[model samples]
Target: MSKQVVFHIGGWSSCGFYSKASNVLASLSILFPSRLKVVDHKYGSRDEYRSWLIGTSGSGFRDTFGISKASNQTSSPFAWIESSDGGNSFVGGCDDTLAWCKDFCAPKEEGGEEKAVHVDDGHTKGHGYDYDLVVIGGGSGGMAASKEAAKFGAKVAVLDFVKPSPAGSTWGLGGTCVNVGCIPKKLMHNAALIGEILSSDTEPFGFTAPQALEKGHSWEKMREAVQNHIRGLNFNYRVTLREKEVTYLNKLGKFVDAHTLSLTDKKGKVSQITSSRFIIATGGRPSPLNCEGGELAISSDDIFSLEQNPGKTLCVGASYIALECAGFLAGIGVDTEVAVRSILLRGFDREIADKIGAHMEDHGVKFRKGVVPAKLEKNGEGKIEVTFSDGTKDVYDTVFAAIGRSADTGKLGVENINLKVNERNGKIPTKFEQTSVPNVYAIGDVMEGCPELTPVAIQAGRHLARRLFDGSTTPMDYKNICTTVFTPMEFGTVGYNEEDAKEKFGCGSYEVYHSSFNPLEWSLSEHRGKHPAFAKVIVNKDTDAVLGIHYLGPHAGEVTQGFGVAMKKGVTYNDLLDTVGIHPTSAEVLTDLTVSKSSGKSADAKGC
Candidate 1:
């Protein structure tokens, strides 16, 4: 009797997991006369493909392959692939695993160098699955997991619905963070700042900008440039996936049954696929606010595609997104207004948030506090009319809804798999991102635990892959996870805030050491008063342990990253003081701050 075999094909890539997968497939093909085929799934189609693969049940091949479901799954090493054009090719996954298996396999078309090698190992004893383990999702985590498992002689396959990272995209192969989120966003932010400095303050520095300033930092050009760079990343990622021999599938995957997933393409075709183990790093989308007339508002996704700044724009919410976009608009001379309820940035020092607000207002942005839109509608001219709770109204050309974002777990069919979710947001719960379902797990933004920062997501995904497939099961440590808001004067923080520490310790006696100064860059410039730097170190009075480090100034993001590490390592206030300060740098203020014998210590007469 002919046995039906299931392959967990993911996007094209030639890296870690992909390489191991190739070896597993080659060994399996030698063990059984089966032809491995690749499948593609596109968008704008009907139901995705349905494979013969089971969603929840094991196959007769599982016992023969000697594979069993993980009994105590917590966290595991994993990587996955992603591709466009329905799996015609793939890219991005795990570069490390592919590097490890570089010498083992050659491309099928570049064959004739080595004949198929047979394996005499015990790996060929699973019953339900013709192969032992079938890994799903071809993102960085998925690819890494599958490849490592394969190296250990476990059968693995990765699946992805989107296009793989461009060729040689080592980081981009992982997903959005490398492709669209962190890197690109920072680059754009930097470019916008440059535009501001050149246009706004060139004269004060005895340098004159070009006769005619450019309009609003050419959003279309930046978008096109970033997209091209992303395409290159996609290419590099694909090459890595393919070289590793991980099966590439370009289709949207959803739970068809417990152990199986159904993949659909844009053309409505479908394939049923199954895996003994799975990892979900689908990430999150910007949350939507159900404000009246909010239909006219745009989310972060829309902001990415903008070609030009709107004539008049209003940014709603108080998260980093709102502050950053508002800063950009104001910097580029757009008529921008920030409308927020309560104080902005709930996690930062209240004083710092207020200063940032004042800085932005001074830079030409209009701030309206304690008021939000009761309803949003377009007037006869198609302009947005925002009616506030106080019955006052204002019109604008655009409104950005930056309230917040939740995990993108709705279509994941978590309910079908008995995955436990947090009661507050229906988000899948995990100590290290392991869901209730034994074989399935989640990380990154999709998994609810840590702050939703891009680096954190990438780190989580990378660590997950290592533990599951590479025999390293280290849990994520978020004790001092550093984060920043990309406003003009950047704000960054790590570790516990004063209120949290006080509550946890049952004492509100922590010492707050802070310093404020005018940065040297503004020394010779007339804009000295326009930009000020601030730093705060919250220390435990009893232990002198640095509980938190927060900063509002230039290069705050870069500076706070290192500070976060110190805080995580239980660095004390003396450790901060002993560290050699960078000469004449804004960050030096952090280490240079003198702790006061009392609370709320003031700086020198110059505020430095």
Candidate 2:
């Protein structure tokens, strides 16, 4: 009685014991062989499925369309047709199947041409929401997820706003990585590296003594160049959203309820909006120093864009942020010092962390152990007078509080929705990025236990959007992620550190293969390359699989990125030995790892 019918995804029946919808269609097909149509689900045309009946039971529609009930979205792909207003007659649900057949047999003038109305899903106009998805924070994760959902023909919006730091430092749209975090940090690190290279006595490399660098480098000039590049990235993120047709809201959002958000613009304007789904990628901010006159200190948030030179600076913290800043400051001849309350790089491999500390120390970054700044105040010379926890005192032109960062979820109103957040760090706990509330999700540093890295956030966000909209079954893999610490020596690591490996595999279960090699790049250079590069590989003794890899050398980021890819295959120590090595590369050390730390023989290399 109809032209044709297709079931793209058959719904479940008898608790998934049988494909009930497929049986229903088959029985009907026998009665009307010429009128009914059925095709393999794989062969189903992409565009034609929109008009076809998505055969499903009450709960079946959810699986049929890959829409989870927790999302609270209509459990049908043709939901727009069912909700269409002031339109032609519509048929929905399995009960209406026979009724539609009867209508298809009737005359055209009688309004029975088997016609189906077409509607766009790009905007949830007819659906019950101001937007399909609203993302809080315009950082790497939020922006990546928003653009991906929009690409799948879903309406998406991103909301972001920056609160000025204690020192009145503010930035643009691309969030921490592009603004004050990775981008600026890397640029400044490179600038310091270049200065170190130029000021070096490079007689072996055929470079003459450089008298031009006799005048110390200009911190203002480098800061300006870094800021200019960051500003461009910020503008590009905004333009990307516009090009993708995703709404860009320069407002801060707080939850009013499960689906409602109270939005506040920069000018103190307030409004309310609703969305079917929410993804929080708010990230974190530098914690303010909590001591007397602590406000006098700047943080990584303000250091990249500092107006004046940070002369004779004291970096107060042992975290990577503190070390990186200290490294660069010392490299550029700023006479930098570091004050530590505890161990450096607390969560990293202890051995690697110790080497980095020693390397920085040799490079002129002073360290004051077991002490934190108890008080910071301006002295008569305008330098900050800092009182240590040990009752000692010091003076410095600038004090940088690289203490740590806190997730910016305090005012996010997650409590209103009963979303349990990590009270100490403000990180939201999630399963596959899904929060306690079904329709809400969390990604990036804001999510509890996820790596607080930009690339990790971007990968998680993109994967999350695919699962939400593209019927993808892939979940974000949080394990074995490669990361780097941009200290002066540069440390790159992936998978478990040695301590964690021992804890996971137990003593005598995992053996450590390590080497201390002098790179050809540094073998003859006495001016810059003072420290020999180190490498370590943690292997499961039983399985021979590489449990972890760590590298300390130049371009650690570049060397580690390839390991990240090879790691996906579960590469074993034998597999590494089976492959040939690339000559004179820092990464090749991983493939040639033969000296076990347990052997007690020195892991040092004499030749390249």
Residue lDDT tens for model 1, 314-429: 89988778888888777766788988887788876677788888888887889888988889998999898999877888999988888877665666666777777765564667
Q: Give RMSD to native, each candidate.
A: 22.3, 16.4
As a TM-score, model 1 comes out at 0.72
Candidate 2's TM-score: 0.79
TM-score of each: 0.72, 0.79
lDDT of 2 by residue, 1-608 (tens): 44444333322233221234345545656766786654322213332332233323344333444433323432222221221233322233444443344333321222223222212223334668888899999999999999999999888999999888889988989889998889988888897788767766376788986875877689888888888889888899999999999999999899999889999998999999999889999999999899999999998888999887889899999999999989998988898989999899999999999999988898888999999889999988888999999999989999999888989998899889999888898989887788888788899999998999998999999988887778675777777889899998899999889999878768998889999987777766785445789998888785567878899998999999888776766777788888788997878888888899999989887665
How much lDDT does candidate 1 score? 0.64
In terms of lDDT, the poorest run of 10 residues in model 1 is 45-54
lDDT of each: 0.64, 0.79
Best by lDDT: 2
* Model 2: per-residue Cα lDDT at residue 127: 62
